[model samples]
Target: MKLKLKPAIARRPRAMMGKLASAVRSKIEMEKIRRRGGPARIRKGPPEALLGLRRFVANPRQFGGFVSGPALAATITREIDPAAGPVLELGPGTGVFTRALLARGVPEHNLILVEADPMLAARLRLAFPQALVLACKAGSATPEMLGGLRPAAVVSGLPLLNFPGREVERILAAAFSFCTADAAIYQFTYGPKCPVREEIMARMELSAQRTARVWRNVPPASVYRITRD
Candidate 1:
């Protein structure tokens, strides 16, 4: 006797199996790198893309469907001054922006990366051994995490639109707490406007300006520069 399966159910297993195969391949590649290694050299393309996609499927609200492209990363970090001070990066998924920051002359040790995903956080540590990687949510960021260094600017990759207003306020408030007087927080959103709402900005005495729109991004995104009013 054979059991019949619905199309939806049959399709789910195939998708899961495909993801599993991808995970297996990623693991094999990691193992190869580990064996051949001095420092763990995880290359910067397909593996990270696969991991980002898996995390996106698991939690769309927290992880967007695609990683930030190089153009998007470069655009967002364009205004950042590497000589100013420490750079606080939230949701540094696949460290695309982190790499861009480095390219812009920000030293590895001057970066403080806050990533919520454990797997991604571990990879970040491996990928950037000199930079500080904290595996915690954006709202949980604090001065203590910075270890006495204030951030000159914040380059956030968080999906703030998916969060509630209060949480958004909290995250921004925390971000500003340890920042310099001239600091600005740079955020990108797939939406038509700023991801951080107006009320939250007003309440915090913060102001936002749309800096750039990158059509090259996967879904096309707008960059915003927010600073204290």
Candidate 2:
């Protein structure tokens, strides 16, 4: 029987290939920045866009795009209390949001970054040696992954809309387990509604509020503060 190409699948490869090409270019730029000795500082020229593209090529469903610009990242991390306790960052791709948390007075040692990409995790270790970096998926986050530190806040960059309902629930539950009772989960989404599923939010007794909308980002995005009280 002759097979017909599914439109979505057929278009995916070309889009992914183009993204991979851009991602490669972005990696080259990162290597140069790494050599210059300040990996945390964001730079112009195919930086966030390239990293986002590369990640999109690797896992389109799991990432919307990189933290577009510092405006959004800084906004997402605004509520984290640097001295209150440790902070857990999910999918700290290219460390843009990670840098923002650091800029906001969070201690390097108190920040724990969980990144699914081994390559990115390796670079994060070199960039922020004091910060703990775990190379693992969001679905597998646990207190053990954080070396037993209870996080005061959770700042996530994981693409929730790309995940199935179960996976999203699992990731959220795991991250929240480490947070204090009144802590917040900061997330950014490009969609019209919150990235988190409404049912999951209701089930988890979480409340979400859009704190900021940043048009300066590559594609405009809004930051949501998710809290469990």
Candidate 3:
């Protein structure tokens, strides 16, 4: 006579099979990534994009729920001058624009990346060892924090529209605090109008001009160049 198996024991084989299938799928995906030159090689694009999505889901207001595509980064940094001096990037989530900045001749050491997310900041530090990666909010950044380096241009990926009016001014004020007199801040927004409020701009004596638009991004975005009015 055969003995009857308990319910939990009977389910064990099915669960094991499921786990095995999952492991196989993971292995196949990893093999694909390896063929494409491994995770480190593709870190800049795919992995970071996925990381950004995860961050966005964790905090929609903070991350804006969208990653900046290469096209948008290219558009935002189109007019940047590599020789202008140190480039400050605000909210550089997966560093899409940072890569563009490097491609445009900006020295890796001359880049200042401000990321509030500690994980992203750590990754950035690993990705750009020479670059200064600060894990803090944009509004909280100060000249002292920058180590007395004045950025000639600020490439912002911050979702300014999602922030409060006062906070927006604070962030902008902080960004321009140590910048050169002629320095311009480049910001991108998904809205039809400028992300920075008119009153705030007037109060800060700043003027914004729509420089470019990239429709290839997840949500079409407009780049604005903000300068002293």
TM-score top scorer: 1
Stretches of candidate 3 off by over 4 Å are: 1-42
RMSD for all candidates, in order, please. Answer: 6.8, 10.9, 4.4
- Alpha-carbon TM-score of each model against the true structure: 0.84, 0.78, 0.83
Instruction: Write the number of the candidate with greater lDDT, choosing between 2 and 3.
Output: 3
For residues 14-36, what per-residue lDDT tens digits would candidate 1 score against the true structure?
A: 89999999999999978877897
Q: Name the better of 1 and 2 by TM-score.
A: 1
lDDT of each: 0.89, 0.84, 0.89
| Local accuracy of candidate 2 as per-residue lDDT tens digits, 1-229 | 9889999989999999999999999999899888987765444357656866787788787666464688888888888878899999998888888888989999999999998888778878887889989998987977776777988899988888788999988988988888888778888888998988899999988889999999998788988999884
Model 1: CA > 4 A from native: 1-39
